[model samples]
Each structure stands twice: as structure tokens, then as C-alpha cells.
Target: MVQQTDLAIAPRTAMGRAVKHLRQQGIIPANIYGHGQPSVAVQVDALAFDRLRRAKNTRNFLTLRMPDGPNQTALVRHVQSDAISGQTLHIDFFRVDLQERLAVKIPLKVTGESYAVKNLDGVLLHLLDALEVECKAEEMVEYIDVDISSLNEMDDIIHAKDIKLPANYTLATDPEEPVIKVSPPRAAALPEEEVQVAAPEAGTPEQTPIAGE
Candidate 1:
């Protein structure tokens, strides 16, 4: 279910310097590869591509509907950017096989504070930013959400084993991966004993101490 937006962009036809000019106008030249069909060169809105790339839900699973041909169910496989302006230079869209399981990295979304952090004043530490998974095209999720409301102790760590994964989705990452944990935050400055005292006890018995002695 692709949400329709006015973010339409015409495909790019020019190459070399011409393409560079198009990119300067906030348009990105790209290509779509699908279903044994020859890859087609397309132009995407530079702003639109940037927005879609950062979208929380469609960041991973997105299908592009071509005006001339059939809809391309695809994922962004690669992206190139301008060195100075940081604008997108090109993007690669890979056609998806609905029946095949694809392995992709999806971001990890954590919601709700752990009880340990709330009651014990501990900090919630996130270990994993994303996880790889094997899933069919339709079952591909943009992200994996881990709920931390169950954590109840200072050392409570929520590992991959504790994740409530979606149906038909299997973890392709290490099972023992630590996703989140609760630990006390470090003080900005060390306590008295934690700080290193002056070696040689300052001037103790040394040549004379500075005038401030």
C-alpha cells in the first residue's frame, strides 16, 4: 500500500554533464532493475528521494509504480551522492521476487522506558541500531520494534531472544545480540577517590612548592 504523494519526478534522459545539471536542480538520476527486464534509467526528485530514504515506515520496503510499465516492487540497494553538495547522484532499485525470502537490515525501534531506568534512575543503553532478517516481500518490515517496559533491574539486558518478532519473519542476525539494556549513567566528573592524586604528592618534600603552596 504505497501512499500516493505529489512527489512525482520525471525520468532522466541526459547523461554525463547533462545528468549533473539535472542533479543540480534537485533531481536525482536513477535506475530500476526488475523481472529480467533491462534496467531502465529514471530520474527521481532529489528532495523526494531523500525524504523516502529517511522515512520510518517505507525506509526498507517500497514499491515504485512506473508510468509506462508495470509497478516495480523494489528496495533501494545503493545510493550515490554528490561530494560537495551532498545531493543524491544516483540510486539503484532492485526488483523483488515475491516468493523468495530477502535478507535486509531493518532499523530497531525502541519504545517505552524500562522500569529499571525509571525506578532505579538508570540509563537505557541501546546496543543494536538495526537487525538483519529473512522474510518474504510482503512480510518485510521497515523496522523491528523492541519494547523495553519489562526491564526491571540495573543490569537488565534485552537481547534478540527477548524480541517479539513478527510472524513469518526470522532473525538472520546473531541470536545472542544485545538489543537494549539498562545501566546507571556515569557522573560527569569522577568522585574524590576516583580522581588521580598528584604524583610525588605535589611538592611534598620536593624542591620548594610553588608560591601557592
Candidate 2:
């Protein structure tokens, strides 16, 4: 079962430019909408939200506890941040139905050392970083681990079709897609000293005579 994280939220009356005041007071304005439900404007503690975001997988379901309404199960859909200051500007929570299967992108974590890379001097290339998968909210995984230890020779590849999924999980990505590969080591540039210029043969016209001769 997917782990659940809880966050306390409250209804927000601020809108437009007025929402700036909420941020000034260390509150984050947010919206919750999904499953064909009307969007709800809400507010949450900035510090608390930051901690939750840094500590947990944002893709995991979040239990939003509201002061007046019933608790909501949501996914942290999006977060808008200031490009310069890196401050959280706004957040969007997508409410989910635990019983329904949903498609979400799960990060692909590369694990285990590749023997080709360690001993054969091969270069390991990570072609894909995430996989799109469909699974019930209750069965969603934090991330999928892709072991590269199977890569024992150059040109060895791990394709999406080779990935094993948990029960009830189905891949949304194309099976032919290459996820990772071990490539032959890059060719090293020749050193300047190794770049030979043929010298003129001893009696050739192209040879220059010695100054004293």
C-alpha cells in the first residue's frame, strides 16, 4: 500500500493580489480540484508544506485535513515557485479516488553498479529518468528501482519491457523504449606529441640544408 502523508489546510478567502498578503504571513495559497469536483481555494502553513515536500514523495497521496470540510485525499499535482527567489508561490492538489486506477509518472532510480562500467571501462548511459504507469492509488509506489548490475558488457541495454512491475501495476510507457545502456568508452583524443608529421627523406629536395653546410 502507498504511504499517506497528512497536511492541515484551511479555506482561503484571499484572491488575486490579496493572496500576496497570505504569503507574507508564511501561508501558502493553494487549490484542490480533481475527479470532476469544484475547485476549492485553500491555504496551508508554508513551513509545514515545505517540510512535507522535502521529506516525502510529492506524488504520494496526501490527506488534506480541512477545518470545516471532511478530509481530502489528494496528490500534490503542481507547485509554482518564484524563479529568482525559489519561493513557493502557489500549489495545486489533485484529489484522487483510492479505488480508481490512475496514471502517474514514477521516478526511475538507478541502482547497483554495472560490471561493464566498473571493469570493462564502459560508459553507462541513463536514457530514461521516469516511467508512466497505471495503478490503483492504494498500490502506487514511491519509485521504481532499475538495477544496472545486469549490464555486464558494452552495448547491453535495459528496455522498458524488461522492467518488472508490482502486481496490479501496468506500464504506460512504450515497451520498446530504452531505459539504460552500457556503451563502449569514449575514444580519447590523440596527444599533440602523437600527431606525427613525416620528415623529408635524407636526400629529398624538400629537406632543408644545415646553415653551416
Candidate 3:
């Protein structure tokens, strides 16, 4: 089932340089638009937006509550931020139709330790950190877990096709792409031996070359 978060916002009356004061007062400028809809300028409370962003994936459904109009469903499309502080300066909310499928990137999370790594001293290599999938906004997930416990030997690989997805969700990434692999442990480096310089033979050690003899 799709989850929805309701956020209250007000239509933006300020524009251009005049909007700087809104940010100073903890309001984040934003825009909302989608198919068959006119772009609507809006503003959301900075602190409230921060909390919501931290708690949900960008693919999640958001219901924008407007002061004087009907609420709209949206998905975060882009965020503009301060280069120095990384603070959000503006955001673009793409209105979404819940009934339509959308392509989204879900983060990959590794679960379960590999027996080969623990018992055989094999090294684990993570090749992919995320995967793209197509699903309705309500069916989108924050992350997909990939289990590594089945890797039993060095050179064993887990490909994108091996992943399992929720019903109604289809993978968008190439099926042959490797998501994880195990490799044999690296060889240890050998220590260098010290070189010994032999002294001159004892018999003629005192014989110095006679200059102009």
C-alpha cells in the first residue's frame, strides 16, 4: 500500500530578490507542476520540510496542503541548495499520478554476512550501490536488501537479475550487472633482506697504493 505524508504550504507571493527574506525567516521556496497543470509557486517551512525529507525517500508520495486550494499529490523532483552550507534554497515538486508507473532508484542494502568471507578469508566487493526500478509511487520502496550469505566461494557473484522485487515492481537496470562478488584474499608482502658488504680480504688489507712509486 502506498503511504502518504501531508505537508502544509502556502502559495508564494514573493519572487526574485524579494524571496531572500522568506529564507531568512525559515521558509523554503518551491514549485509544483505536472501533466496538464500550471506551475504553481509555493513555500514550505524549512524545518518541517527537513524533517519530512530525512524520514522518507524522494519516491514517496507527498500530499501538498494548500491554504486556499485542494491538496495535490507530488514527488520530489529536484532540490537546490547553498553551495557552501548545503542548505536547501529551493525545491521542485513534480505532481504525480498515483495510478501511473514511475522509474526510481532504490538504494541497495547488504544484509547477512558471507560464510566465504568469514570462514575462507575471502574478500567481499560491492559493485553496485543502488538499482533502478519501475513501479507506482505508492509501491516504491526506500531500499532493497541484497543477501550475501549465499556466497560460498571466491569469485562467486550476485547479479542484478538475482534480486527479488515486490509485486508490481519491475527492474529497470541491466540484468547482467554484478551487484556483489567475493574474491580470494590478497597475498602478504615479503620483508626485504638486509645486504651485507664484505670487508677487503685480510691478507692485503694494509697495502695502500703508493702514489708515484
Q: Which has the greatest lDDT? A: 2
**C-alpha displacement of 157 in model 2, angstroms?**
1.2
Put down candidate 1 lDDT per residue, 89-167, tens digits, no spaces: 7888787776778788878888877877777788888898998888777676657889999899877888887888788
**Model 3 lDDT tens row, 1-213:** 446788888999999998899999999999998887899999999999988878864456789999889989998899999999988999999988878898888888899999989999888899999999999877777789899988998889999999888899899999999999998876522356789998888787677789999
Residue pairs clashing, model 3: none
- What overall lDDT goes with each candidate model? 0.74, 0.90, 0.88
User: What would the per-residue lDDT of candidate 2 be over residues 1-213, giving only the tens digit for each residue?
Assistant: 668888999999999999999999999999999999899999999999989878865667899999888999999999999999988999999999999999999888888899999998888888999999999988888889898989998899999988888899999999999999998866732334576898878887766789998
The pairs that clash in candidate 1 are 11-43, 12-43
Error of 3 at 55 (Å): 2.9
Q: Which stretches of candidate 3 lie above 4 Å from their native place? A: 56-59, 185-213
Poorest lDDT segment (10 consecutive residues) of candidate 3: 184-193
By the TM-score metric, which is better: model 1 or model 3?
3
- Give the TM-score (vs. native) of candidate 1: 0.76
* lDDT against true structure, model 2: 0.90
